[model samples]
Target: MNAPLSLTTPAVSVDIAGVNLSYGTNHVLKDVNLAIEPGEFFAFLGPSGCGKTTLLRLIAGFNQADTGHVRIGGRDITDLPPWKRDVGMVFQSYALWPHMTVRRNVAFGLEERGVKRAEVERRVETALGLVGLAHLADRRPSQLSGGQQQRVAVARTVAIEPKVLLLDEPLSNLDAKMRVQVRRELRDLQQRLGLTTIFVTHDQEEANTICDRIAVMNDGIVQQVGTPMELYERPANLFVAGFLGTANILKGRIVGSGAERYFEIDGGTRFPIPEDDRIPDGAALVFRPQHATLTDQAGPQDGALSLPCIIANREFLGASIRYGARIGATEVAIDVPFQSGKYLFEIGSSGWLKLWPRSLHWLSV
Candidate 1:
């Protein structure tokens, strides 16, 4: 399982510096910059049409940039065509040739590269063996399962032993349960090969589970880049906060002077800002649902801000309970650990959301 691909070079770094791409009047990628470390599993995470796929193709030499350079292992590959770039890309659809057997599909790339007959057979066998699909080599793409087809696509790509592996939503077509299984397999395969891989996906959970780090994108812009926990806990802005997970963003006016500032939640109570915290212009109060707990009474909560809220709705999650409450002119969600036999808060009941002061973040719009 180790070094089965017989890669010529060690894992290489991919640097996209000042890259910008557009189509006439439509701007796609905007000033995108990233440094993918050697042998690191990285991901471009964002919604569809955020230029994630375009960026991946750009690295694979399928898309050209209007400005900046793309360097692979310090070599300027910005001008090379796709085949000469020494990069392998697994498309979203897992584009398999239905007419070909599994063995032929994986061997196609090697054959096209003018690889020797003996070498092509050896590499194809090794690639299929690496993916645990050698037994099904004679089966056609239509005869294999969806997950199997995807592995064939991966096998074909790795058979080339490219410097960098680019995956564009490779798991999007599978069922939820199959997706979980295949992603773990993908992670294992990547680790065994020590390949520097870049995965493009809109699903945050997929990126968080397997990738080493993620570059969060939005509107063709690189909004923020960090580990999954970093982006979720300390997001750069409102979009990052809301996109990563369920976030409660309360917008309102700021009252009082410099040292005595307060966030007045629209038609609701004023929450005092921490003296050490800085509030940017047009910033809103941001916090995750789990950061706050619901209580029947406001008592004295040290280092916590108690917001008076009325329980408007409730949802029973397996491990926790989610409560939708109304405070002032806004609605926010609160999650409490579910305890069997514990008295549930009634709908329309007046309660308080006990928010930890340390968990609060003031972010701009």
Candidate 2:
């Protein structure tokens, strides 16, 4: 069990500079640099083997960076031991002591530091209460539900009043419904305590819904870092655009010159590219499926490009319908909101899609 939290501890900023780590020839993290604001709920998001967890461990002092500086609240702690760093880590496994009662688990840290019995009791009770598990203080971890056990882990971490909180996939053990519920609670708790938090998760939805900013990583390198909206709307590269959301990448070549310039797909379908900048010679056009609309008519619009396509398949997604369309030699995706019995098209039927020129994004191939 962890001690009760005191909101008086001011949250601290975290800075990682030129961090490089590797297990022999693997080269896990590559010159990673990040600046996390004080009291910010930040997430390190990526797929497995992306080094998100390794980066989190480095901050927590569990993994040593071969060449980098780690500073918390402007104090260099790159060489500090884990216990001396004053950072609380809630691991993926929940790491609870099954034999001990919840209260004792929460109080373990305080007791280890030689806090008086009365104070430990007070803080332990308060911590358990904060997690809504005060009544279960005497229960063992094996006797509690998964969500309860997760709460116990959090209570244990928060009770220490560490300057920063590190969470490594804390919600991965919970069911889908419980994950949603507990994540909300976690956000609320972090805000109330004003703790600088860094959460590592492979789930995009978890990162998008819970954190204020996210750093997307892949191949042991940081790809893009931004708020969810920024990354989704204006990605920095092809990897970011494709990873953050469902993007329909269409390859094309820039044809003509000046105001008459347009991108012509391989199959003769054309769409106007934005002016004021040089379009890369072999850049690709990208757009989300939702940005396009489908219609039976095959005609261009004043501000839209109409592409003749055939419906290859349709998927019912409860609130919306997704259609897989074939245009020329490329396949594009179209999303339409479900309206009870809106016009339904057969799989093999031909349809036209209207895509706004402004909605089309360009990226280097």
TM-score of 1: 0.97
lDDT, candidate 1, 256-326, per-residue tens: 86678888978868877777777888889999999998888786497788888889999999899999999
What candidate 1 gets wrong by more than 4 Å, as runs, is 1-3
* Reference-based lDDT, each prediction: 0.92, 0.90
After superposition, the stretches of candidate 2 with alpha carbons farther than 4 Å from their true spots are 1-4
Q: Per-residue error at 34 for model 1, in Å?
A: 0.9
Worst 10-residue lDDT window for candidate 1 reads 1-10
Cα lDDT tens digits for candidate 2, 1-365: 54436754688999999999999999999999999999999999998999999999999999999999999999999999999998999999999998999999999988998989998888788878878999999999999999999999998888778899999999999999999999999998888788999999999899999899999999888888999999999888788889887999999788888788887887888766657755666889889999998999868876678888989999999989999999888988889999986798899999898888777777888
lDDT of 1 at 260: 83
Top candidate on lDDT is 1
Indicate the residue-level lDDT of 356 in model 2.
88
Q: Identify the leading candidate in terms of TM-score.
A: 1
